[model samples]
Target: MNTYKQIEAEILAASNILITAHKSADGDSVGSSLGLLHFIEKLGKKATICHPDKAPDFLDFLDLSHIITMDQEPEKVNTAFQEADLIFCLDYNSTDRVGKDMTPLLESASCTKIMIDHHLDPQDFASITVSDTSASSTAELIVELIELSENGSLLDEKIGTPLYVGILTDTGSFRFNSVKPRTHEVLAILLAGGVKHYMIHEMLNDTNTASRLRLQGFAMSEKMEILDVNSVAIISLTKGELEKYQYKKGDTDSLANLALSIKGMKVAIVLSERDGIIKISFRSKGKVNPVNALAANHFDGGGHANAAGGMCELSMDETLDKMKALVPEYFPVQ
Candidate 1:
């Protein structure tokens, strides 16, 4: 029997439920939360979705009007946190990932906490946890939960659409090493259940403004640097450049991956200056687990093995230099 059979029973017993993902919401986090929201509502339970802040504008088509963002509606989020009998934390490994403003509320909430995540070394905060580092995405694990629910018919269009988006984005459209045969199997089922693949692809990748494209071009031409000796590439963007280009939240979503497209590049780093901090993203190839070892040890961040993110209080130059220096230590050149 599936381990989630116990979680299914817990879901059946709960009344008011609250769902949440990490701050600076990504497609996987948003998709998993909304997908689970639809599923819980189908079970006739009062379910509410909340995020520490707003999601990206590109995700507006997912019917997220029901989601309560603490940045926008703090009082409502507070009320929901207080009233919920069960709280589902998705995608993030720690309560700190939910933002400082949200940490206190979550810490005080007298509810059963359930964590469903695909990250490494999760803190023991949740009462129940379904953590698998090998899973492609949290949405994939959520599907496992749904199948174990006895009512397997719950994987319909409403639930499948966001789940598909989660898996698609986290797996880099099914190109990442984490994507197993079962990942493709789940995707096939979602497609058969009415996930509009071509349309979603267009909306996510093709629906970009001219300024966004120009910004990417400028970053590649002027800001990108190659360290051939270490097989690493770096792209740094300043706050002034972002303002000049009319940058939006998701503007740099594909920048790191773009650098990785180079033939000999084994690792790509993107450093963007924001709010007096340098935000860092690390993408690596092969067995060099940046998320588990490099990001955790140096940058105070962790995620998947190949893709991870971190932040530093240093200037862009200092951060870039630090990352360049660490490459040899984490991923020595052959």
Candidate 2:
């Protein structure tokens, strides 16, 4: 039997199902988890989405009431894990991506585990793994899974919308090089299934808060630094500065992209001190850029070629110094 057939067979046999995504929820993580949940529901089974933590405030427009997060209800999340007969891991590479709390529950769970992700170097933790690095987003992969199941009839606006959001955001509104013809085809299918593309666009991009806007302006005008000779831009914000601007979790998400937008900049790095660590986000201009390895070797993180993330326990100033020193070796000035 094919993979989708195996997935269908597994679903048919399972009684309780649990869906999970990584910590630091983004559009793909949440959208893929929810899209898979809706797809499972269409398959005549129920699934629970158990994220490691709450999604950022900007994503509050979605119906998140059904998701059980470890941050809010540890006991309930534990109960769900214990009760699950099948688990779907969405948009994350390894068990550790679920964070410390959920990782133990996931590792200890005796249920059949399936992972559907679009990232590099997937761990061998799941019984069934569907990982494709070339795929634009796990949301599109979920739609492909449904198509593989030969249940294309089951897709509707409810299933398509979240998946659409996932594809849109993860592809940087289809601006990223990761986008392919297959992505646009999948999007067409979703649109045919009643996903209002423009509405999703408006809801996601136009929902920026006053604080968020101010934060972005402050980051651009004040915090952002340009290393003109290195063709790099850097933005580092301390916790105090973040607090002064009423910083929220997703507030600085676009800072790296903003930095990368500068003329002649080949790379951009954004760092913010949060949760006792200096969080770093990297964005680069080329497909073969070494940002991924640079992140792996220096920061405690790794991701795609042009986009990656890492964290540092050092002070913000020290982290910035380290980053400035390290970046030149990976991406010298043109």
Candidate 3:
């Protein structure tokens, strides 16, 4: 069994700490970091969150606005990291996903390192690793860590909100296959601590802007392509198209899942251009492991069996050709 006392002892001994999460900063990453930040601050320690990219607008409600884009400036981040007595990596198993740009900070942090994540096949990089794929979200682990450290009673509304958001998003509003009864139990405890569920729901689902809705419509109507006898659905969007639609952030999050609405479709892929790189999001249902497909293609990415992601350096057409060739290996003919 894994223990948290060592981590707790390190935290207690450290005077300064730096918290970080994976790139693209999803709700789970942001929420877990903020949740831990609140707890560490309560213990009278200085904690700073440094992420690889800015979080989506919906997550702005988490009181993390100040820390949202800290990852943009590498030199500033390195200065903080160098001075920290400890570094906590939350919701990510690998340093690569933490942000390609922050590699130096991660390598140079002269502090006790800890990693907390729920992803399968976590890379052994930190001094202490607390990973359980069974957990719904890293926020859940943060809650457990807090309780184990006898800090559960210290949770407040600020911390509760982000923790609830992580649970809500990763479980797909409790609809994903990962939604176990214990997940509900954890959520119940968070709510009892004054977490507002409706606000989180609204922030995640109800706050879409007009441009984002238009972008979704365009992606569904024109960008979506069905291949392999309806087994795969691909949606591609260019940066110019997104800019034309005045896309804010987090607009394309649901594009992959939207293809799942099609009957008999087993896999969905969303390919979008971001700063000259092709970002791919993969989702599968039952027995279809998109991560395997991604890994086989020389793309460094992974996630749950039902959802995975990666990137390719090729253009849209070239990337599609590779995906078309690679996807069929995992989804064979019936």
RMSD of each: 1.3, 1.1, 1.8
lDDT of each: 0.87, 0.88, 0.81
Model 1 clashing-pair count: 0
Ranking by TM-score: 2, 1, 3
TM-score of each candidate structure, all chains considered together? 0.97, 0.97, 0.94
Q: How accurate is candidate 1 locally (lDDT)?
A: 0.87
Model 3 — which ten-residue stretch has the worst lDDT? 288-297
The TM-score, computed over Cα atoms with residue i paired to residue i, of candidate 3 is 0.94
Query: Model 2 over residues 75-121: C-alpha lDDT tens digits?
Result: 99999999999999999888999999999999999889999888888
Over 51-131, each residue of candidate 3 has an lDDT whose tens digit, in order, gives 988898878888775473544676767777878889998988887877767866787776788999988889888989999
Question: If ranked by lDDT, best first, what sequence of candidates would result?
Answer: 2, 1, 3
**Per-model tally of clashing residue pairs:** 0, 0, 0
Clashes of 3: 0
